[model samples]
Target: MSTNPRGPNAIDRHVGSRVRLRRQLLNMSQEKLGEELGVTFQQVQKYERGANRIGAGRLWTLARVLDVPVSFFYEGVSETLNQPGFAEGDQTPIIDDFIQSADGVQLAQAFARIRDSKVRRRILELVRTLAAEEAEAQAAESEQA
Candidate 1:
């Protein structure tokens, strides 16, 4: 064995925090969520603490149970949006704001309904392109300020 110890970093903690927050907002108990996910409450605790990695399949199941997209865990989590990342405590408020948005919830639902991998990739690409364009526009506006 390589004796490598697995541990979550700042980003993982951020994702976990988002998951916990959404669960709370939906008035879900960790035990209830675990029952839905076929996991133990302890496992749910691990996920909420970022003590274990959530696999893609498990994440998908979680999204369904949470009534959100897998991407919902990552919203408001970009490095640019959070200075010093989650470690500096800057992203929590942003994540909370994102979770409260109707548009964000709609987007999450739309993302969850996309089954085709290629279509999902295309959607991500399109969103990235749109975000880039928006950023450019913002930059232009700032320059004129």
Candidate 2:
């Protein structure tokens, strides 16, 4: 099989995404992580973006700094590799893409703060309705085009 000449294979990207997820979950800044790792914030950005591959030693340091086990980065990797999109060379997972966004984080934090289960369900229903409407609008626009 031909390899990516640019940078970072699927495993690298997946690992990087897990790192990003953990960092964000802890509300840790790339600059802070860089300080802990003795690297620049730009370097941390590269690692998170999968523009640069992280070595084993550095990965270990990252796990320690991020307060997770070394194996945390490998979770869900098998399932991701087996997905149809992976075969088609689509590296970005939809859920990860959403969770990595600022809006997604804010929404998740806010949703989690709501103690009422019934209210949370209503909010979920509202979001679903909005998403369905958006999908319908896009479908209609595409048909017109």
Which one wins on lDDT?
Answer: 2
TM-score of each: 0.53, 0.83
Candidate 1 clashes between residue pairs 3 or more apart in a chain or in different chains: none
* Local accuracy of candidate 2 as per-residue lDDT tens digits, 1-145: 9876776987887888888888888899999999999999999988988879999999999999999999999998876677654565555477678777767877888899999999999999999999999999999999999
> Which candidate should be chosen as best, given TM-score against the real structure?
2
List per-candidate RMSD values in Å: 11.6, 3.7
- The C-alpha lDDT values of all candidates are 0.78, 0.87
lDDT of 1 by residue, 1-145 (tens): 5533576765666677677878876778889999999999999888877778788899899899999988988876675346643576555566555654556655777798999999999999999999999999999999999
